[model samples]
Target: MALLKRDFIPVSKQQNMKPLHYPDCIHLSERCGCDLLSISECKGESCSFCQSAAQQELSQREWLSILNTLGLEQQKKIAGKYYSGKMPWKSQQKKG
Candidate 1:
């Protein structure tokens, strides 16, 4: 009896075989706040539509804007602690 050798490819290399482009969920129009064309040209970190899609549970853009007002160290601290416990919904509770 002869033993046969099997070839295996790693997942990381397999992923590079095809590039992924997600469709625009939030259509950018004159009514929408962001300029889709400009945002598309750069890395999508600051894009509101992309941010909202990635963090579906909360409003990422609003948090990002608030973080921007704080110092870099404070921003890191808040971001690290944000997921540690229940988020304070004081404002939302007051609204109702």
Candidate 2:
């Protein structure tokens, strides 16, 4: 069967799929990362609309764990290139 427009999720949508049990965040629909239309990248604990701190923390941890899968040198390179050697998550850890 041929697919319809609504039947096909964009690649961007596939990347920014909302976390399970995440709230219907206003920013999700307002500032979407997918086509800049459906939902914005989740801000986790930084989002004002986040309903549950525990859920946000868990989600952030999961995302961070993905980076941990990378080799130590590759991770360091990414940290230096993108994060200027100061990881944002580490700062948040200090704050929380």
Candidate 3:
């Protein structure tokens, strides 16, 4: 099941930048919290907790969808000097 934007409860970034502890992740529930802040990035393909990376892929897709909503100007401002109009993924697609 794909996660909708409604699945998340937006909290102030400053208030929860670093959580005191990581609660057990419950995928598809409203109680789901951001695990990125507390855990190290990993492939997670073999992690039982990630259900063979399904959770990882779902989270990535959700975040990327939100990012894609940004206009070129907004994206450029965030990307700073590296903000080429063309993304690396687009360039790679052209080469192949």
Runs of candidate 3 with Cα error greater than 4 angstroms are 1-52, 81-96
Model 3 agreement with the true structure over 1-96: per-residue lDDT tens digits: 332233233468666443332223443223443344344432232334543255566765665665557897766665565645545433433453
Candidate 2 Cα outliers beyond 4 Å, as residue runs: 1-23, 26-59, 90-96
Backbone clashes per model, in order? 0, 3, 0
Per-residue lDDT tens digits of candidate 1, residues 1-96? 212222233448546433333334343333333455644332333444553344443564555456566786765666568845433332334443
lDDT of 2 by residue, 3-71 (tens): 111222345744854333224433343233332234455553355554444556778887677776778
Ranking by lDDT: 2, 3, 1
Cα RMSD, model 1: 16.5
* TM-score for all models, in order of appearance: 0.23, 0.35, 0.33
Task: Name the candidate that leads on lDDT.
Answer: 2
Residue 80 error, candidate 2, Å: 1.3
lDDT of 3: 0.45
Q: Which of candidates 1 and 2 is the stronger one according to TM-score?
A: 2
- Mind sharing the TM-score for model 1? 0.23
What TM-score does prediction 3 earn?
A: 0.33
